[model samples]
Target: DQQVKQNSPSLSVQEGRISILNCDYTNSMFDYFLWYKKYPAEGPTFLISISSIKDKNEDGRFTVFLNKSAKHLSLHIVPSQPGDSAVYFCAALARGYTGNQFYFGTGTSLTVIP
Candidate 1:
């Protein structure tokens, strides 16, 4: 059904802790996965991404792990800071579609307590 789902709508963590966000997808054709972070009124910015062929991808403070066989993925942030408070969206791109059609989960708002 091309639905990407974020099970948790929000998450709260204290500063300097690790924050984990989870996502699931029903579509098996999705070969590309991405995580986007957004502030209050701004648009989402790409954080990390992993191709279906790979199991994990990492940036400076963020890491994304994908389990294609299980149709699951997760984003992890280490040493969460107060600035990390924002909405995170999990996105998936279906293979074989020429146009830019990316499916996004509702989103998970992360609050980093100071």
Candidate 2:
């Protein structure tokens, strides 16, 4: 059972357009949000992240927004480039008594057309 779900399997956008990736979670106990980007044959790399206490976080060209009431989060990449084309995964981190657990979405493949 996936606590996190990515509704869109794929998304395409122009090079100069903004790329918005979305994710939803069923668990309200999660305290952290993380976004990762993966290229073919490579492990997923951390793209950006935000704490549950904050609604928005921005880093360079990437921004992450979290809506606690809706249990939704989104990653925005402004002026998306061809190099930014990759599979994106959003993960929720839950701190439990046993250990920290991470729930990951299925992933959304993003293609930036140049």
Candidate 3:
């Protein structure tokens, strides 16, 4: 099932500006905790994240906020740069019948214009 979705497939932002990415999940049971960034021909890397118990988490220029009531989450990048251009994925940890499972959004491709 497609529990998570990124409505915007792509986003373009000017360098030194702010970039925001949004994601929504259908399953309320999902315990969202991570955002990932993927570059060309590389593995996805952990970005910023918010635990289910907390509404927001920040790391360097990245921040992730969660709205559990609305099943929505977002990632914010300040002063976006060309190197920041990549595919971003929002993921959640779902405690399934068997064990802990991860659900990921389709991903949103970001373009930062220098």
By TM-score, the best candidate is 2
Please give the distance, in angstroms, between residue 8's alpha carbon in candidate 2 and its true position after superposition: 0.3
**Tens digits of per-residue lDDT for model 1 on 1-114?**
539999899999999999999999998888899999999879999888999999999899899999988899999999899999999999999766477579999999999999
Candidate 3 at 51: error in angstroms? 0.9
Best by lDDT: 2
Model 1 alpha-carbon drift over 4 Å, by segment: none
**Candidate 3 per-residue lDDT over residues 13-40, each given as its tens digit:** 9999999999999988887568999999
| Candidate 3: C-alpha lDDT | 0.92
Cα displacement (angstroms), candidate 3, residue 109, comes to 0.4
Counting clashing residue pairs in each candidate, in order, gives: 0, 0, 0
lDDT for each candidate structure: 0.94, 0.97, 0.92
Regions more than 4 Å wrong, model 2: none
lDDT of 1 at 57: 92
RMSD of 3: 1.0
Error of 2 at 56 (Å): 0.2
Judge candidate 1 at residue 92 and give its lDDT: 96
Candidate order by decreasing lDDT: 2, 1, 3
Which residue pairs collide, candidate 2? none
